[model samples]
Target: MTGKLRCAVVGTGHLGRWHADKYAALPDCELVGVVDVDQEAGRAVADKHNVPLYDDHLAIIGEVDAVSIAAPTSLHYRIARDFLSAGVHVLVEKPITTTLAEADELIELAARHGARLQVGHLERFNAALMDLDLQNQPPRFIECHRLAPFKPRATDVSVVLDLMIHDIDIILSLVDETPERIDAKGVPVLTGDTDIANARLQFPGGCVANVTASRVSMKMERKMRLFLPNGYVSVDFQNRVLTRHQPGEREMFPGIPEIVSEESVFEDGDALMAEIRDFVACIREGRRPLVDGQAGRRALATAIQISEQLSA
Candidate 1:
């Protein structure tokens, strides 16, 4: 809380290694250590960053002021709970935990210890999404598609949790309302869990979102389209492009109104760094994070509901 905040990255796998690198490069943070169940993997990252390596998170929990948890979804609750109970701030990856009850417990534990709990809803930091001018324009209809080729790394959870949850969080944030009902369907292709799924969410205010995610696709695509009362907006997450369509003053024909289209493209931005910086800033400033425990809980709750419908 004084000079520079000490931080550690737990579960130094594919994503956790980058978390360690970012913390090491940040000026306001000190990369204290890295933890991983795989000792070789952890040691490799630590050596590259010149930080200490630990086999277990418990060994480094007392050494850091904050921790980034990129562990497996099943271990999220236990790992995050231990750190938060120790009064250390946490920035855990998305879907906070496997169950709603676990998420609720983590939120309560963070508050009890006065520790900040942030969720890694990475897309919320997307440059294209961040640039959208959707302040007053509430979307009436939202459509999302996140497709990717099969990868064996995250097969422990269904595609809904692994991929669709990103769009779910974004839709939930934009609507700011709990969904009244959910209809979902899914099929398992390459894993025991659902590899491709679709969900329809209806909010109280008549806003609806149709989300689809597939891990067995041939190509990768990450896109979302929002239909607002005054216009339509499209965001391409992979390419960092935003396109807007609205009515123009001029008429195209006798009775038809002209439509104006504008497109904005952005460079591949560093969303993870921004997310980590925000977490550190919140901890230092005593402010709430953009994606806090409650928001994470909401997204998880909705995702669970969809998953249940899929199973039924």
Candidate 2:
């Protein structure tokens, strides 16, 4: 922990390139290398950072202190396993893996090897959500809508995993309990996989969340609304705006209290960099990350359940 932590990025695709950018920009971290099946894509990122490019993730295992695994969802398990087993810290992207067993194995392996495993639930570091305390004012009902135009690059998976998983992680964190019932429906449009979906989750804690995700929409939107015991909150993830409605001391009527509204626009910032910084800090400080392997597993488990319901 005294010197800079040598880091490598696996799978130099869309998000993986940004991972390399942050690792190189951070003062306490050194961008050691990058990996990809497409050598041209991988070399572009590695060359930008002046680091070597490897054809396989395992090629850089022993040389790196940590790695950011942005490989394809199916390959997440294999690459993360080798790195964790070698005692190298890992910051893997969303969903952790395609199956619960794979996620569990990664969690267990990280523990056994004493290596830190963090998931790229990047929204956790959003400026708008930074000061929102979910524990103190737990929500009774939640609503989320995430929409994006169809892109062939991300059609490998359903919209549930590609987009909705972000809100799933956030909602699960706020509810802090397993859902007692899950009602879901989805259908394919542009691709064979589900392009639009909705899931209504009823938690054991008397909380309900209605989540929807669409990849065939004409316009992009990311928003969430929460109904609290004494107030309401609206988070515009796309614009980084947080709005709250609560009761004021003054009354609008003889027996009713007046409603007070407040809104704040947070600076649109780089959540990816913040996520990587936390990953490095967790490795150095010997603490669990905000979105550790267990947390990611929980989100993935719930997502898989929802996906199953859709298929049924």
Candidate 3:
């Protein structure tokens, strides 16, 4: 509500560094500080960005208007809970919390404190997905594949939460409905937890989404295909490309599968920056975030359901 939105980046590790950098670059945002459990990591990022660094995240909570929590998934509930309780708006990474109860608490806390709680479902901001017209063409069937080479960093959780949850968030947003049933299965390969997983979600509208996520893949691929009555859409998350194929338009080609394709290409842009900027703007304008706590909870709940089914 003042000259600039002073924001802090908590947990200055891999993703946190990107958050700090984006806040530093935004003219409307003031990078008040960076915090991490690892003091060296925090100080190094702050030094690079020329901002104050804190070893304890709470030290900067009162110093900034908002925060981006990029800490470990386990710490999300505590950190986000404390920040929101203190009336500091938060932009938390995906899988808002490890459990549905924790996610619910944060949602209520944000509302009670009158603070914004934004979830980092970054794919919603992807240019390709942004352009697709989801008017009356909600998919009856959705297929998603999110595969990546083993990275020791995010293996704390299963591939369902780490990777598949992204697609789950997108699908939930697109379907605009609640799931009626879910059946899932997975096996742990590289890690003690599930390294590859798949889920079939059944919604009330007869919509089904078949989602698969793997962290033990040979190469990386993030793609989704939506099948509708009149046309189909394919999105490549890695390349930010969208291809659409629709039915024939001309009378001469009536009843024929006349193919029309347009590749929606977006310039290689910084998604992290876009996410942070949107958070800062929300803080300044007091507007609800595009990915609010309820939105996050929807995705997290679906993921938990799938993970439970896998365990069974």
Positional deviation of 213 in candidate 1, in angstroms?
A: 0.4
| Winning model by TM-score | 1
Error of 1 at 275 (Å): 0.4
Each prediction's Cα RMSD? 0.9, 1.1, 1.6
- Model 3 per-residue lDDT tens digits across residues 1-312: 878888898888889898888888888788888887788888899899888878788788778888999999999999999999999999999989999999999999999999999999998888788778855987989999999999999778988889999999999999988889988989999888999988888999988999999999999899999998778899988899999878667543656666777788887756677777787777778898889999999999889888888887
- Model 1 clash pairs are none
- Which residue pairs come into collision in candidate 2? none
Regions more than 4 Å wrong, model 2: none
Candidate closer to the true structure by lDDT (higher is better), 1 or 2: 1
Per-residue lDDT of model 1, residues 67-151, tens digit only: 9999999999999999999999999998799998999999999999999999999999999999999859889999999999999
Per-residue error (Å), model 3, residue 21: 0.4
lDDT of 2 at 290: 95
Ranking of candidates on TM-score, top first? 1, 2, 3
Candidate 3, after superposition: displacement of residue 68 in Å?
0.5
> Number of the top candidate by lDDT?
1
Candidate lDDT values, in order: 0.94, 0.91, 0.88
